[model samples]
Target: MNLYPVLQTADVAASARFYRVHFGFAPTFEADWYVSLRHPLAPHAEIALLDSEHPSIPDGYRERARGTLVNIEVDDVDALATRLDAAGVPVVQALRSEAFGQRHVIVRDPGGVLVDVITEIPPSAEYVAAFAPNE
Candidate 1:
């Protein structure tokens, strides 16, 4: 199954640009009320932006997303963090290594989505036992 997130935002174009600039996504489709983006090297990685008030969305569910965090795995979280900092992107969570084997940073997108950029790292000794046997 193919799964991708469709963000409902007030400004679809601005939201699309934010992903393109910060996450290396290129637009596959674009319209005033919607846009679809895919990573050039990873076409399976996709995201869509839609006008929050689009008629197709049920009225009750058309509101902007809240309490949602999108995780995007990358090869180098530290380098991305530095680039984002240089570009003045707001970092909600500073770059840090987690005991569960992740080096990551959290940033808020223009549409208020929390994007957790991450890289896999060796798990801390103390946390290694928490993983399932196969893992």
Candidate 2:
């Protein structure tokens, strides 16, 4: 089964552009109050942006702020980070490599949702050795 995360944003178009310009997501469906995007390479990975003030949103949801994050796994974290930087997107967390074999960066979309853009990389020898089965 595929999972889709829906974000409530003040501006649906701006939020949609944030994903499209930075990550190359295309709109599968769009309206004045909502938009659904499909990942460029992984169709199963999807995101939806909805107007915070739209009637479809549950009552009182519009009054609360969005505090959740959306994680996107890509093939090249650095490349995507560069593109986002060139486009003037603000990075909340600098690109860094982790011991868990992931290179990632954190940025806030226009909707104020934190998005973690990540890609897998070769793990450090120490990390691998630590997890290696006892010889």
Candidate 3:
């Protein structure tokens, strides 16, 4: 199954622009109250922007309280972070390299969603050896 996350926002157009301008996402579908974006190169990578007032959303979520964290994997986390920094996007968490061979940064989207932008890197030697197959 494919998973397409929907981020409810106060301004659907603004949020759509944010993703498009900063993350290279293109709108596959758009409307007055909703927009669906797909990565320019990766068609399977998708996220939807929905106006908070959209009726399809449950009453509980209409208040704009979302607990989900969106994770986006990129080829270069540092480069994206630099561009985002220049564009005035606030970084929720500083860039850090994980033991599992990933460099990531956390940023808050226009819709108040936490997005973890990650790129795979070489894992620590210890971690690599730990996951090695038995001889």
Candidate that scores best on TM-score: 1
In candidate 2, residue 5 scores what lDDT? 83
- lDDT per residue for candidate 2 within 1-135, as digits (tens), equals 777888888989999998887777899999999999997683557889888999877786784236797888888889889988888888999999998778999998888898998997878876786565659
Q: lDDT (0-100) at residue 67 of candidate 2?
A: 73
Question: Which candidate do you rate higher for TM-score, 1 or 2?
Answer: 1
Off by over 4 Å in 3: 129-135
lDDT score of residue 15 within candidate 3: 85
Across 66-89, the per-residue lDDT of candidate 3 in tens digits comes to 687888889899999998888988
lDDT of 2: 0.85
Query: Residue 8 of model 2: what lDDT?
Result: 86
lDDT of each: 0.90, 0.85, 0.86
Tell me, by lDDT, which candidate is best. 1
> How close is each model in CA RMSD to the real structure?
1.7, 3.6, 2.9
Q: Which stretches in model 1 have alpha-carbon errors above 4 Å? A: 132-135
Candidate 1 residue-wise lDDT at 34:
93
Encode model 1's per-residue lDDT on 1-135: one tens digit a residue. 888999998889878988999988999999999999999894469999999999999978988878989899999999999999898888999999998999999998888889999999989999899878875
